[model samples]
Target: NSKINLAANELLFREGEAGQFAYLIERGRIAILRDSAGEYQLLSELGAGECLGEMALISHDPRMASAMALEDTTLTVITRDHLKERMARSDPLIRHLLQLTLKRYRQSLGQTFPDTSSTQDLDYLEDEQQAMQRMRTEHDLSHALDKQEFILHYQPIVRLADRITTGFEALLRWRRDDGQLVSPDLFIAVAEESQIIEKIGHWIIDEASQARTRLASAYNGKLSEDFYVSINLAARQFPDPELPGVVQEAIRRHGLLAQQLQMEVTESQILENREHAISVLHNLQSMGCRIALDDFGTGYSSLAYLNRLPVDALKIDKMFLDDMLSDQASRTIIAGMARLARDLQLSFIAEGAETEQQVEALSALGVEHVQGFFFGRPFALETKKEPA
Candidate 1:
């Protein structure tokens, strides 16, 4: 369906026009023409399997040459979005090298075409040194998985009524070879953009599932009946139709009850691909796993969609707790969320309650559960006693 039919002698694109797509000749020939003064002259001819119009996509410039179908051509069109997405996922070293090559090509164009040098060229040259640093980081990330350098830290989610630890959210940390610990914020986006999140996400699910039993045992079986390990699902992983199967396998392999594994997702993640997201969530529910809406009230939190979702809990964002003491608006919003959660029969958890007073205020606002440093910070399983 992405294939297009072009008539013989058809102009695909003209020089001086913005390039929106690159085309692959699937079944015919294409002519590449360059304009000199006011007359267009043949520059090159391309046959089937050849690609054209891609330079502008990489260089962020107008088409340098025009393309026309030499015959009844069938071409596969690659959109700018597709190219840009792939470029974003490529290593910084490769991207920089590509830009450098393109820059030289542009410079050589001065003999025939107009000189196209600009500030963008200067910026690319300036960042040449930064490429090595970025390349090293990228190489480190590529090997981090094979080296088993990732670790999980659990933060207690405490029940307000009895002040007991009922569940813990599993947080990921990258431990570099040099003994440096990297936070998720530092490298998660990179992993997601590079498509490494899929592999890492599966590993997290497996680790958390295995940890659930050990955690309960560590607490001498005093952990509540609702004891669960909450694993944050990356947005990039949801599009995989096999995600539910992955979770099911994790729970089954670890001999865990599906309810003991909670999957946490943010609002924006759900909205980005609503149909697929809903399908994946429903499949998870069918396996008896629970779903929690994390970072609630921060993004795309629509009541209409919220009520329709197969969610079991609401985790209020930490920002609300940060401002709850000084801002009446924050408290009012927390109160409304608590009441909404209760009315909907969903569990309510307020995050980032650092002080007793904040916990008191959250408790007064009808929050049923809380998670923050006030109870216990995120502690590694190997370094610390089991979550209190």
Candidate 2:
């Protein structure tokens, strides 16, 4: 009896998975699918005000088909406990019929009954389904990269001190032939797990370098004065000994100062293979490339030797700013990170800022670099430099 909001194309449940809950669509449409010859066959589409997976309420039967939101949808969720309680109070004949119906439905799907003494088996089934889906997505992403279906979108980063646009962060976007945009939230994690991140990381650097050259041309050779495009590197990529050389080559090929490009890695990524990461960062810095520790202050490692990490900047994670105005503790922590950055002589950037008040709060805390909606949304760019 609670509402859940789902983004477009979000999965609600899969075929053959135990139905732990059902939903009534309050808005948008849902696509029901099933496997047919190794591909998904859309069986039907449900629209607003329709109930889904209601049969599962009567018995502990598995789902018969997959359900996915066709658009942004809001659904009223009906928990299993409520359904079970209602069933218990029903007439004996009705309950018996429901059990028989569910048994036949499972047999129709060629499913075998499992020992259901606990819910562990059901949980495992759901997990396996999700894993399989991710595997398929990974395959698609590999092909996407080859076909050039992927592209980069740049979001502006500004300096609070001068209120000037310094540079942009090169973010990834996957646009399919159908003109639908696949969210990075869905694919980035899968790419990271499948070890395809290294190739993606390289492509991003190559693209960002080319873009920087263009951005500089737009500024009549002045973009490099203080402007720098930041590219994110996965922690897993650290183990690739060739990474340093690869980045240095990109900088050399563009004939741009390394300071015009920055590489950002999360705090946790820095610790994934600390020794290897340290070596790579040193090599990058030696080549004049600036290094930024992204999502700063979120890692579990102690900050005892932060100075030894070979980083030139720290990006205060957005989680700290979510409540900076209402929570004094959040503001204090942000101020401390700013002070620490100053003492270490490393630059600091505040991310996820969205308002003037938030900007003022960050300014008072000594954060001079900030990037967020407060600046502007990311806009698409041509690989070649455009007139600024």
TM-score against truth, every candidate: 0.76, 0.66
Tens-digit lDDT track of model 1 for 1-388: 2989999999999987877788988999999998888888999999999988887667657787889888999999888677767766666667788877876787688634343434535544545676777666677888898898999999999999998888999999999999899999988877876678888898899889988877776653236876999999989999866677789899888899999999999999898888888788888988898899999888956687787898999998899899899999989999999999999999999999999999999999889999999988888775443433
Off by over 4 Å in 1: 1-43, 46-98, 101-118, 121-135, 219-222, 383-388
Scanning candidate 1 in windows of ten residues, the lowest lDDT window is: 111-120
Total residue pair clashes for candidate 2: 0
**lDDT of candidate 2 over 194-268, digit per residue (tens):** 778888888888878877766655442113266888998887788876777778788888777888889998878
Q: RMSD for each model, in Å, please? A: 6.4, 17.1
- Give the distance in Å from residue 265's predicted Cα in candidate 2 to where it truly belongs: 0.8
Model 2: lDDT to the true structure: 0.80
Clashes of 1: 0
